[model samples]
Target: MKAELDLARAFALEEDGVTAIEYGLLAGLIAISIIAGATAIGGGLNQFFTGVGNWFSGITVP
Candidate 1:
């Protein structure tokens, strides 16, 4: 019974579990920001390349 009580006390005072959860949340936020920035940049690049292609197509090679 004494050992069980000590074990329970140790678990209650531990901070590693809470720290891991905080790190997980931080990592998730970082990943979300990266995904959003990449999506915006990808759309802009696609539009820029399409415009360049259209301009090239309008040229006469004569």
Candidate 2:
């Protein structure tokens, strides 16, 4: 009976599960931010490159 009570008390005081969950949430947020930043940068780069291509196409050499 004493061993069971002690085990129950220890289980109640454990924080490993809570710590793991917090870390997981932090990782997920970081991943989301990185994805969003990359997408925005990619869009800007695509537009810039397209404009450059248009300018080059308009050039004519005699």
Candidate 3:
């Protein structure tokens, strides 16, 4: 009975699971921020490239 009680106490005091969960959440947030930033940058780049292509297409070459 004493050993069982000690084991229960050890389990209760352990923080490994909580720490892992916190790290997982942090990683998820970082990934979300990276994706959002990439998406915004990609849209801007696409527009800039499209404009450049349109300008090039307007040029008349002999």
Which digits, one per residue and each the tens of the lDDT, describe model 1 over residues 1-62?
99999999999999999999999999999999999999999999999999999999999999
lDDT of 3 by residue, 10-30 (tens): 999999999999999999999
RMSD of model 2 against the true structure: 1.2
lDDT of 3: 1.00
| TM-score, one value per model | 0.82, 0.86, 0.89
Q: Rank the candidates by TM-score, best first.
A: 3, 2, 1
Which candidate, 1 or 2, would have the higher TM-score against the true structure?
A: 2
Candidate 1: segments with Cα more than 4 A from true spot: 1-6
> Which 10 consecutive positions of candidate 2 have the poorest summed lDDT?
53-62
Off by over 4 Å in 3: none
Q: Clashes in model 2: which pairs? A: none
Q: Candidate 2: global Cα-lDDT? A: 1.00
Q: What lDDT is obtained when candidate 1 is compared to the true structure? A: 0.99
lDDT of each: 0.99, 1.00, 1.00
